[model samples]
Target chain A: MGMTFTSNVLKDGLSRIQREIDAAFDAQLPVPDDMSASLVEAMRYAAIGGGKRVRPLLVASVAELHNGSREQAVRAGCAIEAIHVYSLIHDDLPCMDDDDLRHGKPTLHKKYDDAIAVLAGDSLHALAFDLLASPEMSNDPAVRAELVHALASASGHKGMAGGQVMDIAAEEAGGDLDLHTITRLQQLKTGALLGAAVEMGAIIGRVPSEGRSHLRNYARDIGLAFQIADDLLDVEGDEEAAGKALRKDDAAGKQTFVTLMGAEQARAQASALADQAIGHLSAYGSEADILRELARFIVERDR
Target chain B: MGMTFTSNVLKDGLSRIQREIDAAFDAQLPVPDDMSASLVEAMRYAAIGGGKRVRPLLVASVAELHNGSREQAVRAGCAIEAIHVYSLIHDDLPCMDDDDLRHGKPTLHKKYDDAIAVLAGDSLHALAFDLLASPEMSNDPAVRAELVHALASASGHKGMAGGQVMDIAAEEAGGDLDLHTITRLQQLKTGALLGAAVEMGAIIGRVPSEGRSHLRNYARDIGLAFQIADDLLDVEGDEEAAGKALRKDDAAGKQTFVTLMGAEQARAQASALADQAIGHLSAYGSEADILRELARFIVERDR
Candidate 1:
């Protein structure tokens, strides 16, 4: 019954973050009453529809555990999700992956052409900062500045952008990238933002630096687990559930966890990671129950 | 003699900003020792090289008038210039303007491929915010937060991105957009960043909000003048000097200040605005001298 209750709360937590993120976009980024309407429309198109909401869930969960304000956590969630969506739009461009579908619909580039899509992504990136800078996110300006800095460090050249460059180079070079390098790349590319998400919640709660380290450890475990799960999904995820192209990494000769360690080992590693991630939270009590369940769910989920 | 002295200071001011901005890029964005090297190279490709360095100059000039720290001003200048360079890189994307060259060199997309170009631009955008959030930019965290907020407001949907949408829409609609709409478009597209440059400089100096209005007015006037001059350059500038395609705006049949007011009238309007812009700084004595000269030069410059 205790496990069931926590799972239910985790489910609600996911949906709540999704709703708040959607509303945050609508409330903050209204469609302009002119030709700029299309730009906002494309931003809305990318942001609103659907995703797993994992990043936001992490933010909200950690914030709640620390007794941070719900509204602030929700707003932070929107900010991180905006960065994630913007990245996907850029990633799916014609010169990038050139994918046409996302979440079972035509990608922004496919639906609205390339120019609008580019501006839309650029605008969403701006919106993330705008949201974080707002009073809704935090009345404390220092916290706000820290959030902006952390997000940029995670998402910019030093982090996601840097990792993306390495990803592209790996593909162009055409060989099996070493496991160590692949792990580092994934840490920068995906893990940085994921770590930022948890760190943001810690900031929201005013968690001490010593306390923050444990959260960071938890974030790192989940981040690696999430990516390993993604690699596993690509290999075996159902097309309908996954809602995007899959198994392309192997076809493209890209290095992935599954490729380096084999599918079975990768799955085992993901499980170990998820368990360790939950272990880091042992200090937090029942207040962190939802985070614990979510960790387990992340490795087990099909999509 | 006073006017000549001011002009010389203005010249050194411009060169100082150029050198400082180039050095800022070098110092802040060191290339990693991996595949990310190419991404940093692409970012360098776009951010370095020749351009007027107008935005940074505006920032430094205004900052100096307010007695802001020179080091702080140069850092702020780099932040704004980072945003400007990022904008150009995105603007030159094949899906947008299809530009092959910029500042007499190959565009990022042309030189590094489209994916690299997009990520480089995105990374630079992130770098701009990161720089603003840097400790070197300010010791006060609140000031850093305000800088981030102001830059985002000026560059985001309600600013550059919003203006870009209307511009594309104006072309797609295929008609003479009304003068009112054209003015609004340019305000968002070009004017916003120019205004932000001045506002940021004022912030760097810790100028009170009331003390900042004159700078705001000065910025507004110069922003309009800058765009009109750009329109003039398109009609009459040398391809070798301008370092990019020109006359394309007219060829595209888009609504522009020059098109609406005629080249002669547009030139006159630019001169009038430049005069008004200079007038806004009568309060600052010799400290304002460089800003006044810079305003006049903006309209008179060939490129």
Candidate 2:
């Protein structure tokens, strides 16, 4: 019952990716022997503080599904994670989201000063590309180049940056957004990088163009689904479990999927999206079962 | 005597890049009737504001040298310039350099609030990558990928970020820095993108590896030389001529080549580095002479 199918392999892959991510983060700033001890320790504390390595795990799982090397995928996964953390640091700034709780502890900006948090975020963003361009991916410069391009596109404008601008504009504009507007907002704000995560793994794995499209579609669904679940979690999630203050969106008067669609429809939409995402796997035979399950796990997870 | 031989051709190339950059900045925005007018305007202001267009010109020049289409190189050059502007915006933030002036005008933060400046900087950064990954480069995914990778590496840590970190650390520590440390910092801070500009051009043009290496060396030397001259400008430069505050580095107690090496030595070093940079053009024969002139101009210019 436990070990019959290859689905069990995903757990191992996740763990390996977790280990690799930790190693990579640790390796990111190797305590410049001459630098201030306090600064180094603060950087380490900010980086090592816990979060579910969901994004990197997504990359590893997708890479394995493509019959690509998990090792390479994990490296890219870590790079994405680094970028995510960097963004989190910046988002939590006094000028930005200004959150105190992160990963069940004080956020980087809360723990450190706003300046340190800003620098840390900036450094981490830079490091993400450094990790991608490193010798680890040297075997195929083209793939490495693709990874960088995809991540940058997703991380920068027309993706995350655009989404951020939208978020800022929406917050300032102070009106109920149409459903289409909300969808477009979330797609750019969150879906861009999540979609890129899947697309990047496929690109690095050398998946065919059509396969790349399928994976991208799958990622788009799950990316939005992930955000929707996040919105739902914000309304109903436990502070301790979610590792941050819940109901932030409600407090901010932000219009979210849960707010617009209502909880029941949102849940239904999440389920529908998960099903459609899993259906994309039909092209890969049974090898994509884990990706299917992973989608379910994303929408279903309490955290 | 004023226009000189080949200056006309180089000016034409620069003019084309400027127009394309203006169009790219205007056209590539997210299409909706009502976008953030202020943000868009800020982006346009930051990007379209008159500058030397040195980086893009380098890209176009290097592309032509390699028999690559100047159109392709122009795209890459515009993207790099966007990144450069983003850096300038961020660097001028209150938490960073706290500058009031840039390029003879009020800095972004000076003109707007700190928050908008930060957002503008972030947006420009993202837009740069978006431009790089645009359909023009997308036709050859591999080339597009390489362009992304090159810009990311130079812009991110181990390049610009590393230099910034060193700058902050050095400023905070405030010790007599060794020649090696100063060189390392400037190389990362300024030289990285300068190097990236030339390399990005070569990559877009599909120059051979040897040719790319030569251009990189050329860029590396000029980049450092450019910074050395900047240091000199900060020291001995007049307010009217420099178009910004003069001797601010000394006033702020920041370390600079002029402060460490003295004005005369800094100028001498710049001249030597400029000559070395021009020497890399031996490969280009006559084609690279404009680049050589550009390097000389960088060091010689009062502004």
Candidate 3:
């Protein structure tokens, strides 16, 4: 069943979302025939042709479960992906993570200059909110406002960015961070955006806050499993398959789930978490099959 | 009358807005007792106790002219100011403008490390939309969405960031950019946000798109005058009073309004534009007196 799910539903969803995200960015950012052309080009270069499109997939799958509009879900997914891509671009900057490769291509700062990279990242950050707030995202202004608020809160200082600060500090702390500290860091850094991805789908589905506990729990579990799997990948996964540098955590002496727990324990923990994540959706029948498959894939996939 | 306006109304308005913006940042971003403290501190450092608070003042004044609530206008103003402050932080990065001083102090990157500066700016960028879409900004969701849309549009690739690209291109083109191109650059770079400042205020007051022509014209005229005055300041103003490095445009061999038209002509154009900006507000009587004074003050102020 897991193999069938990966080859069918999840595969179809990923490809469809990848195409939708590229098309959305292509349509939204037409390079002007003027001096500012390079800025738009840089934005397109970084945004249009990259990444797993996982956030969009999550939004689409969750929204589908709720019988929400596919178009609106895709649009919202694009907004979330924009924020994700922008964060990646900034994180790869020379002063940040100093990454050279992203999605098997040169990082934005390496491809363009640092100034263009910064501006492009900033533009994408603004573009996310613009996409969310635009009338085309949803006819209902309340829905649009809610979407903007959710993305903004998740992306801001107390969420993704704040988590990054903790990650950096963890690196400087020389791998002394405990399990609780590291878990808090990952929750803010990666967990907030992932949680928001599920929450946003629920928002599109008109699911109230009080009714989203199961989905939230599912997201939380998957988020940690995803991070733990990423740590395992850094230690054992192929750089070619990952399409980027790996083992940098060990080089930087950063304390990660694998570093603290050892690979065997971390891998076991990830599998357990993935199973827990899948169980959270027991309330639904096969309608949540893709989500359950996603949980399995999170810990099982090479990348 | 102009003297009375500046010393009384505008003066009070400026100080009041400065306090409001500072207080808003202080209240919104309390430093956490953890590793993320530096990130929040960096955001607060750059956002508080800086600049002229011109954007906030514009929002407050225009919203008042439209009989909008003071508190709501102030909140919206803080959002605009956040965007402005974030732009400044990014612009001052070593990879960008490489400036050392801003608002009479070390730039964000100079004060904090480059990575923190980048994250702080990105966080503040998210914070702008967060503030705009928050329930406190407006009771009507449509209004909050409109505010977010207006700001996001003004700050993205085709707007402020786009203008920055053109400005960089102009520098590479070696002071040969035509007046039309320069005007277009300034329109996007500075004019867009200035225009959005008034547009947002009108949005807060529930002014429909069709009803904002006069205000749009008022904003447009003042926007140009503001940039021209900035160019003049860069040429002849005291760096001490300006609180930033001046004459750098000339050093970079960039074409500015003053460079292209000569200081005398640029000064004349700015004064004319200011008058033209004030003339657009002729529909209102004493209710617009502050705005009229602001227009005059735009071209007349030394820094």
List model 1 lDDT by residue over B1-303, tens digit each.
224524777789888888888998989878778879989988987887586788888878777777888888788888888888888999999899999879888888989888998999999999988888766668898888888888888888999999998999998776658788888899899999999999988888889878888899999999999999999999999998888989898788887888889999999999999999988888878878788888888888867
lDDT of each: 0.86, 0.75, 0.91
Clashing pairs in 1: none
- Going through the candidates in order, the fraction of native interface contacts each one reproduces equals 0.85, 0.37, 0.92
Q: Please provide, for model 2 over B203-254, each residue's C-alpha lDDT reduced to its tens digit, 9 standing for 90 to 100.
A: 7777766756778889989998999988888887888766677877777688
lDDT of 3 by residue, A190-301 (tens): 9899998998899899888899999999999999999999999999999898889999999999999999999999999998998899889998998888888888888887
lDDT of 3 by residue, B199-273 (tens): 998998778899999999999999999999999998999999988999998899888999889999998899899
Worst 10 residues of 3 chain A by lDDT: A1-10
Instruction: Give me the candidate number with maximum TM-score.
Output: 3
Q: Can you give the lDDT of residue A265 in candidate 1?
A: 99
* Model 2 DockQ, alpha carbons vs. true complex: 0.35
Q: Is candidate 2 or candidate 3 better by DockQ?
A: 3
Over 4 Å off, model 2: A1-13, A27-49, A133-142, A212-214, A282-286, B1-17, B34-40, B110-116, B133-135, B138-142, B204-207, B210-214, B240-243, B282-284
lDDT of 1: 0.86
Model 1 reproduced share of reference interface contacts: 0.85
- The alpha-carbon lDDT assigned to residue B297 of candidate 1 equals 84
